[model samples]
Target: MTLAVLSGVGVLAFAGFVYSGVYDVGADNAHTRPVLSLLQTMRERSIASRAEKLTLPPLHDPARIRQGAGNYNAMCTGCHLAPGVAETELSKGLYPTPPNLTREQVDPREAFWAIKHGIKASGMPAWGKSMKDDYIWNMVAFLQQLPSLDAAKYHEMVEKSGGHSHGGGESGAGHHHGGEPMEHDDADHADEAQEHSEHTEPASPSTVPEHGKPGHHH
Candidate 1:
């Protein structure tokens, strides 16, 4: 009888708290220390648990890292600032500032999983929807080396990567937009296509939605 009464009161208190609308939900309002700690712990445990299940691929390949440089520069720089960049307008306005990848190194498994399936409510987008697993891993490869790179070296690597290639027909190959089929002529991009084929089968070209554009927030 006592347990049931306590439970009922607890439920009522929670309901009242919800209805009060006293807690601020605005991004400008920062969470209390306790709440922030709880959230950080929850996020870390969740990522660690899920990341344990992923089988890591070889992430030290030079070609893969080079490919990743271009994608990272084009996609991630706005949010996760690069070696020379301190911050951007987008990064500044984000509720939780995105990590500077140029200063931090993440575990390959965690990086791949987060890149593939983005964190909930965070600015991170699930790249897997528009990108293949192999391409995501390529980004992971670059991340492992990111912390060691200075501005000059990072630019050089990106330049050699040919810039913003998704490695799965989303690069220079025209996308399937406006009901048009993507045209990939082997004669035109024979070398590029061949290089991409070495990693994974070519994915049919599809337009990435505005929200699904490749970028990592964590």
Candidate 2:
């Protein structure tokens, strides 16, 4: 009886493999339902297996949350906007749109690991090599607080948090095409000039004149 069942299963598998000729390897075509379902299942299992051994640090402090917000805004907001924040034109067309990490559905530690290691074949790239471990941990700590964060407060925290600007690719799935680098260069030059002016000595005291007078004594 067992041999008969095995034989039947083998025959079914063979038939399915050959009859499912609709498999389009073209990038333009969306994955078939069965293929998509299988991929999703595999993705979940892969995440669970890899994340099982991850050790998360305690992330209870408000400061860490604030820092994480900075990282999120500069690195993540483009791909995964805040709850009330809307998506920009560039994010609309990515093959696998980025996830909204601010939602309660995501676990902080899991989010952190995902951000640090990134998912393979997915648009997400591992940040572990680029970002410091402390930064990754701070991001995890921040994710824990995202669900409770209001738009106003999230904006404030991000504005106040002092950190380096992250490249757009870190946000999630979308690609930041060229042209932005030119804008950045111009901004950088302006910033340098402003800094130089701020520290430079004031004009000669001789140029100072008496109040309410034009080259004349008061």
Candidate 3:
């Protein structure tokens, strides 16, 4: 009876605290040290627990890293700035500033999980939705080497990659993550589309519609 009464009192106190609106939710208003510490701990433990059992793939392939470079430059630079890039407006404005992955080394399993399944209320997107698992792993591969790259080497790798190409016909356009369209260079769109088309098997002549044939008249 005493334990039940204490639990009720604690619940009421928590409810009252929430109702009071004492904690500011504004981005400009930083969380108190204790609150920040608690959040950090929670996030870390949650990610670690989920990623603990993940089976890691080979993350040192040159081709994989190269592909990851282009994807990262096109998709992630705005939030997680590159080696040469000091900061971006989006990165700066976000309440929890996105990590500069260029200098930060992250555990590959945790990185893969985080990239695949974004953190709640954080600006990270679930790239797994539009990106194939292999592609996501490619990003992980690049991340392992990111901390060691200089600006020039980074740009070179990105240039060599098939820019902004998500395999299986998911183009950079029309894919919404966190309610925003994924952005890439207009010049690269033609190349990206071409790359995607190349991966797709062409329809056999027998399967082609009569009206859709090159010589067919309307």
Candidate 4:
């Protein structure tokens, strides 16, 4: 009888909350501690549960790391914020703000799953629709090496990655936006990577966004 009475009260409380419209759904405001904790628990558990079955390939392969860095610089830099890169334009405003990839290294399987299938309602987009599985794994490989690298090391690796990047007219194959996809040869990529490498100064190690710092020079 007591359990039934408590159940009835719980139902009434839920109904009151739904009808009262007191919940704030705004991004600028964070959820209450309890609510935030609950959501975070759910997200982590869901990823762990889903990713447990997948086998992770060797993530330290140099070729794969090079390929991943290229793709990451082209696509993920704006939000995931590359090594030595401060919070980017998109990262500044994204709710739950994308985690700093350089410091908080994720498990390989979890990283792969998240990259292939983005977190719901986050700015992250599922790349499985447009990207190949190899490309996704390559990005994860780069991420595996990310935490140990400072700005100079990170820049040096990318610069020396031998024309693998698709950005800055280096490739015509991948997700190029707004520009015509004209096929370019290795010579073209080499020239562009060299040019891109020469003029660029490796930035200092960026401060992790402790309190929503804003500014993007990348």
Tell me, by lDDT, which candidate is best. 3
Q: Estimate, for each residue in 80-184, the C-alpha lDDT of model 3 and write its tens digit.
A: 877677775577889878898988999999999999898877778888888888999999999999899987787667767666656754553432212122334
TM-score of 4: 0.69
Please list the C-alpha lDDT of all candidates, in the order they appear.
0.70, 0.59, 0.72, 0.68
Q: Tens digit of lDDT per residue, candidate 4, span 1-218?
A: 69999999999999999899898868788889998898889989999999999988888889889767656655666677766677754678888889989888788899889888989987788877667777788889999898898877776666555433422333333322121221246665575556545644322212222222332122
Evaluated at residue 40, the lDDT of candidate 3 is 89
Question: How many residue pairs clash in model 4?
Answer: 0
- Candidate 2 residue runs with Cα over 4 Å from true position: 1-29, 165-218
Over the full model, what C-alpha lDDT does candidate 1 score relative to the true structure?
Answer: 0.70
TM-score of 3: 0.77
- Which of candidates 1 and 4 reaches a greater TM-score? 1
Report the candidate with higher lDDT, 3 versus 4: 3
Candidate 1 runs further than 4 Å off: 167-218
Global lDDT of model 4? 0.68
Clashing pairs in 2: none
Note each model's CA RMSD in angstroms.
9.2, 14.0, 11.1, 9.2
Model 2 TM-score, all chains together: 0.63
Candidate 4 has its poorest 10 consecutive residues by lDDT at: 202-211
